[model samples]
Target: METMRAQELHSFYGKSPVIQGVSFDLEPGEFLALLGRNGVGKTTLLKSLMGLTDGCTGGLVFGESNLLSLSTSQRAKLGIAYIPQGREIIPGFTVRENILMGTFARVDGRREIPEYLFEMFPILREFIGRKGGDLSGGQQQQLAIARALAMDPKILILDEPTEGIQPNIVKQIEEAIIRLNRERGLGIILVEQNVPFARRACDRFMVLDKGRVVVSGHSKDLTDSVVEKHLTF
Candidate 1:
């Protein structure tokens, strides 16, 4: 796993800056949660990491490579898997085909889906032939995660992964994320609304308000007052 460092990063969409001077570090095998109210540039920050933004400036280094210099596909090949909000799996593709798409970014040229993905998400195995559009929201989220895992990433970036999903499936997804970090030792940066889960699962927390980071510390320091001040809408 490689460390991702963003120094004074700024991202713009058609000259309007959404992420302003945001800086942070995601250490190897670390789980960092991005907590903020809606439209605080959390999603935009994630997009910037993947080079999906209209423009970005300042330093973004993943391992030894300068991420700002790399294309979106190049970033993926470098082991940063981004699962954006809305879980954008191809609607026409079958579960099997959708997952195989991720392998196209693999540097090793392996096209086969890893068996452990099935072990993590058995629902995908059961609905292997089903189109991505046919799956329920929760199942589609699982498929999105499974597809990302297929790329064999060193770091996983997720944007509100459990938002709008069923409660039961939310637990499953949360557990899977924890396992990916704790058991598999994959680094993670999760944008989340569920404060309790974020506090419980993440090693560190960063709170964004407007476009800048207002609070950040170890998970243990994420007190009720901090949430009430910055997170409570």
Candidate 2:
């Protein structure tokens, strides 16, 4: 079975080590929700997984292959797609052009947008000719997700995907995420503060506090006490 494991992992930004001694394992098609309070290392941990950090120590393995040794682009080529918090769509590019950018990492170099992407987020299709910067926040978030899907990645990591979106669009994004995991069998690592959504959609959950994983278990095992202790401010 496919697996991604981090052993005693530490990630640094310049002289500052933001993530220390973090460890976890994600099997194929697993959805792991990463929960944490503000200033914790949740974002950095995701960056480390994608080799976006300044440097990292220890081991990161995906199946039989080692990932820490790979570069950011190399990691993306290995079927790991990261949709960052800021929805980094190119401002000057059209909506279609932004989504097509993800295909650059495809191992087979395929450029076609997956039909399911449009099915999942129809607004992207409707605004295909519009510039990405002109779209609303909800639409940009959807566009970001659609861009990542265009790569046909095996592991999808999203950071606060619904942070600022409207309620209706949040529901749509949530449904899309669940469908991707249930129907497509993609392993997902979601960094989110929405406990209700995380509990409902994830198979397992992990808590990061001050850089280390303080708690982790099946999503069902994540109770109110766990949230109050580690997740709540």
TM-score per candidate:
0.98, 0.98
Off by over 4 Å in 2: none
lDDT of 2 by residue, 1-233 (tens): 57999999999999899999998999999999999999899999999999989999999998887898888898898889999999898989999999999999999979988998889998988999999999999999999999998998999999999998989899999999999999999999999999999999999999998999999999898899998888777
Q: Which ten-residue region of model 2 has the weakest summed lDDT? A: 62-71
Please give me the total number of clashing residue pairs in predicted model 2.
0
Q: Model 1 Cα displacement at 58 (Å)?
A: 0.9
> What are the per-residue Cα lDDT tens digits for candidate 1 across 1-233?
57899999999999999999999999999999999999899999999999999999999999999999999999999999999889999999999999999998889999999999999999999999999999999999999999999999999999999989999999999999999999999999999999999999999999998999999999998999999999887
State the displacement of the C-alpha of residue 225, model 2, in Å, after optimal TM-score superposition. Answer: 0.7
lDDT of 1 at 192: 95
Q: What is the lDDT of residue 39 in candidate 2?
A: 88
Q: How far is candidate 2 from the true structure (C-alpha RMSD, Å)?
A: 0.9
Q: How far does residue 200 in candidate 2 sit from its true spot (Å)?
A: 0.6
